[model samples]
Target: MKKEIPLAITFISGVLLVLALFIPHKPFGNLEEIFNDWYIIVSGFTFLLGIDSLLGYNFGKLKRKEKDAPYALVLILSFFITLTWGIVEIVRTPEHNPFGPTSTFSLYFYNSIFIPLQATMFAILSFFIASAAYRAFRAKEINSALLLVSAVLVMLGRIPLGQSAAPYVITVIFLIFAVYFFAESAGVTEPKIKIAYILVALIFVALIYPLGFVYFRQHIPEFADWIMNVPQMAGKRGIMIGIALGGIAMSIRIILGIERTYMK
Candidate 1:
């Protein structure tokens, strides 16, 4: 009964919502709004349940005298303090309640503390992201080499001195890779051939340094802009389309009762 009722409710809600979207007239016209209100009401109760779970878990840690009990206590106290402050603000100044744009809570708690803390968290996270990107950008193959080149271009393009310095940076990068490849050619059984390869690489870099510097110094930013506006944008749209299609598939499965993971 429990499973059947919920599944039936889900199917009905899904089908009705789909109908309401396509046929917005009379009975179906207000279904979306009605369902949204019901959802909000249900969400409020779920929020209470979340609070209960949070507090209960923390209190259990405190009771058990765990090593992380202090941190748990801090979290519990902070939650109550913030909640109490919000309630007090709402009662004391209903017009400029805690959640309002110009309220004390917005200024002091949200903007002052929360915003800075969030920024700091993201700043810390960027190091980890950079570390991951370093591994991903390693030029093990042709695709990765292109990715590395594009990433370097995009990064340099965004910086203030990137235009002026990009030429030198790119020249140095080419020189390094040339030297690396020249060194890797130690397996060349003949000294003449090995020296010839090194000479060719050096000459190539020398030529590239002059011509590429002149051209890229003027056009690197534009090239980066094109990469971002075209290639990056296309990739992003493709990903969003894939996500939308997947979401639709999942919704259909839920509607048809083919997916019963929620019941479990």
Candidate 2:
């Protein structure tokens, strides 16, 4: 009964929320807003839970004389420093804001730590991309070879020299390379030469006219705008619906005290 009741409530609430989207009446229309407020309150508790968990784990490690004790110490120190700084800044500010120009410690932390860490995180992505490309562009198979060629052409097409000299040609080559690679990977053709020719024709037709029109328009026009707008929005909506349902299920479990994992 513990599990069954909560599960039933989850199912009912989820269905009601989904129905609320189509039928926008009083109470139903306000459902999402009420849920949003509930989410904010839950999130505050979750943040406290995270802080408690972090302190417990780090303090436990420190007591046990763990191998990475120094790192844990550093993490704990940094957490406290940031927390204290934030609280002080909030209290000093006129309306409990720590972001004013007068907040020296806030400005110092933002400049010294936050900005550098953000930059370092973004810089790591470049190394990751290089590693992935090295593993992917081995050219052991026809598809890999086509992918390598398309990647090279696309890189070249982005250059000022390629754009000025033969932009259409470069664009067409990249497109054909992509299509051929996709087709070969999908097992559409066995003959490499025939596949290449078909890819070339597809690229020529797709790029030549479009490039000419864009050149005349003198502005960057999106070719896949419909795909971006319609399909992408639909996919996002579906994902959000799934997320809402999952949240409702979890919330029901929490409210009914069915999920005691938190207590542990």
Candidate 3:
């Protein structure tokens, strides 16, 4: 009975929410407002539930004397401290608290703790990326080799040297990277020709690149931007479509009451 009741509610609410979009008048005119109110109520309760779960988790860890117990304790203390400060501010100046995104507590926390921690994370991420890229760019497989080659092109076209290089010079360098990588898989079978191909390209760049930079340094960043805006945007759009379709399927599942995981 308990499960059936919630499932029925989900199905009806989901249908009504969908209907409200297309039929926003008369019998269902107020569905949007009604549903939004319900959402606000549920969200309030959900926030409290999340807080309860967070504390319960850390308390359990503390009780068990886990090796990471200190971090758990810090998490608990930080949550309560931030919550208490924000709550106190809200109660003290209800009207102003609406704009309290700039409140002293908010500003202090964002600048002193949040921003510094976020910057530190990015700094750590750079080293992790370098190591991962080293492992990935070994050209072990066709796919990884392609990824490595594309990545190298993108990187070369992005940095100051690439940015300073002349337009034609940059294009030639990119072509060389592609050709050199392909020489590995194409059964070229001739080592001397492959070596000569790369060495000649390098020598050419070494000689002409400075002249190109002196004359055409302005076009390097533009070339990189073109690659990203054209090819990268196409890939991103395809991914977004996939995400939207997945969301629609999930919504249908919920509306049909096939997704009961949320109730549990």
Candidate 4:
């Protein structure tokens, strides 16, 4: 009865929510907001459960006199200190400043402790990013080499390093590739077309106009920006579509009661 009741609720709720998007009338109009409220309430309960689990685990370590017992103690002390401050603020000055500027405890802990800890985490993350880039940019394969070059150009173009020249450089590279590809194709097919592409490439390389550097400075960033915005955005959209479809399929399975791993 317990499992059946929850599964029935899930199926009904899922179906109604799906229909609500199209219906948008009466109870359906506010259903999404109601679900948000329910989510908050459920998440609060889950958070309490997590706190209980943390306490149990840490206390067990302390009781066992583990090597990391001092760290566990520090964790418990930090949690209680923060929790006590929050509870006191709620009871004493619930109508205080929105930014909590009035509460010294909250302000000091957040600015002096929290901000540094957050910054330290990000500082640590930079090293990991470098490590990932090292692995990705390894010249073991043609694909990896291409990826490395593309990444370097993209990164440099966005940053101050390649601001004035990246776009023109990238264009030159594209022209070279185009000439080579057309030249190779011409060996098999029409000869005149290949000659035209070669001449076009040379002309682009040799062409000179007054104040060309000034023009390039303005256009280069825009060209580099296009590379990121167009091709990269298309790939992002494809991945997003795949994720959405996967989520929908998983949700459908849960609604149909085929997904019951949690019940195990």
Candidate 5:
């Protein structure tokens, strides 16, 4: 009954929220606003749960005398120091906040700790990309060769000098591929070879287009503006739709207690 009641509430709430988007009238609109407020309140409570879990895990490691216990202690110490500093600053000067100029305890910890950690994590991903690319290009087949060539062109095309040279090179490359395609269609080339060539050529074109557009933007602005507004906006909209659906799914799971791994 506990599970069934929560699941029923989840399903009903999900449908109403989705429907509220289409009907921008009276109670529906008010209900959506109420839901938004509820979400904010729930999130605030969830944040405390997150902080408790973080502290608990780190403290457990310290208690067990784990190998990485020192690192966990460092993290906990930093967290408490930051929290204490913020609380002291907030309490000391109610009339004029000590953290007014954005040089506060919270901001300092975020800039020093959070930003650098995120950058370090992202930088580490480059090694994985290199490893994957090395594996991908090691195949000796025609298709693999084409893939390797396309990847090299893409990497080259990303650089400043290569991008500058891409427009002239792109035109010649396209013409060569077009001739090869026509020849294959007219029975002058083998089907397999033609297919490989066409695939490589299309990949090259895909890489070249961005470079070419950037190059052309120095001479003509309208084309660049169109690419940014039309294609980029379409891409953004697609991403937003995916994000909305993902959030809805997550919310449903949370409300129904289906995603209770966090509690553990």
Candidate 6:
């Protein structure tokens, strides 16, 4: 009966909310706003539950005298300290709310401690990003090779001397790849295929210096901009559309009571 009642409530609320979105009439029109208010109230209680869970877990660790107990203790202390400070500020100086930008809490804690911590976190993430990029940009195949080239161009476009240096860099890369392919062609048993490969490599190396470096030197940034704005934007929009469709499908499943994972 308990499970059935909750499931019934979920189905009714979800269907009503869906109807409220499409049909903004007398009954359904107020459902959305009412649901939002209920959500806010429910969220406040959920936040208290979250705080209880966090503190309880940390306290358990401390009680066990674990190796990481000190770290947990610090976390517990920091939370209470910050919470007490905010409460004290609220009572002591009502005009200067703790949430205000110019308040003591914002200036001392948020700007001084939080911002630097955030920057440090991102700085650490950059090394991981660089490692991932290095792996991704390896010229394993034609697609990866294109990706490497596109990435290089986009990166160079963003920098000050990138436009001028891009041609030379790209020329050097072409030469290196051309030499590698030419070397590979020497081991090929098929005369026609070997000759074709060698000719293609030689032709590419030959054309890069004259046409690429001379004529297209000034247009590197523009070409990079085109790649970013056109191809990148199209891919991003497609991913976003897929995500929206998935969310809609999930919402429908929940509304129909087909999704019962949340009951657990």
Order the candidates by lDDT, highest first.
6, 1, 4, 3, 5, 2
1-264 per-residue lDDT for model 5 (tens digits): 756676677778877877788888977877888998999999999999999999999999999999999999999998888778877887876664544555466576677878899999999999999999899996467678566645545544455566455566555555555555555555527777777766765665665556455554243234434555676679899999999999988987876667755442
Measured on C-alpha atoms, candidate 6 has an lDDT of: 0.87
Those runs of model 2 whose alpha carbons end farther than 4 Å from true positions after fitting are 89-96, 99-102, 164-264
Q: Give candidate 3's TM-score.
A: 0.65
- Candidate 2 clash pair list: none
Candidates in order have lDDT scores of 0.87, 0.70, 0.76, 0.76, 0.70, 0.87
TM-scores for every predicted model: 0.81, 0.61, 0.65, 0.74, 0.58, 0.88
- List clashing residue pairs in candidate 1: none
Give model 2's clash tally.
0
Q: In angstroms, how far off is 60's CA in candidate 1?
A: 0.4
Give stretches of model 3 more than 4 Å off: 24-34, 79-110, 166-222
Clashing pairs in 5: none
In model 6, where do residues sit more than 4 Å from their true spots? 25-30, 94-96, 102-106
Model 4, residue 200: displacement in angstroms? 18
Best by TM-score: 6
Minimal lDDT window, size 10, model 1: 203-212
lDDT of 4 by residue, 1-264 (tens): 989988998899999888888887879988878988999999988988999999999999999999999999999999987888788777888886424777878888889999999999989998999999999998577688578766756775577757566556556555555566556655655567767766665664554231224444555456557778998899999999999999999999999999987673
Error of 1 at 44 (Å): 0.8
- RMSD from true fold, candidate 1: 3.5
TM-score, predicted candidate 4 vs. hidden true structure: 0.74
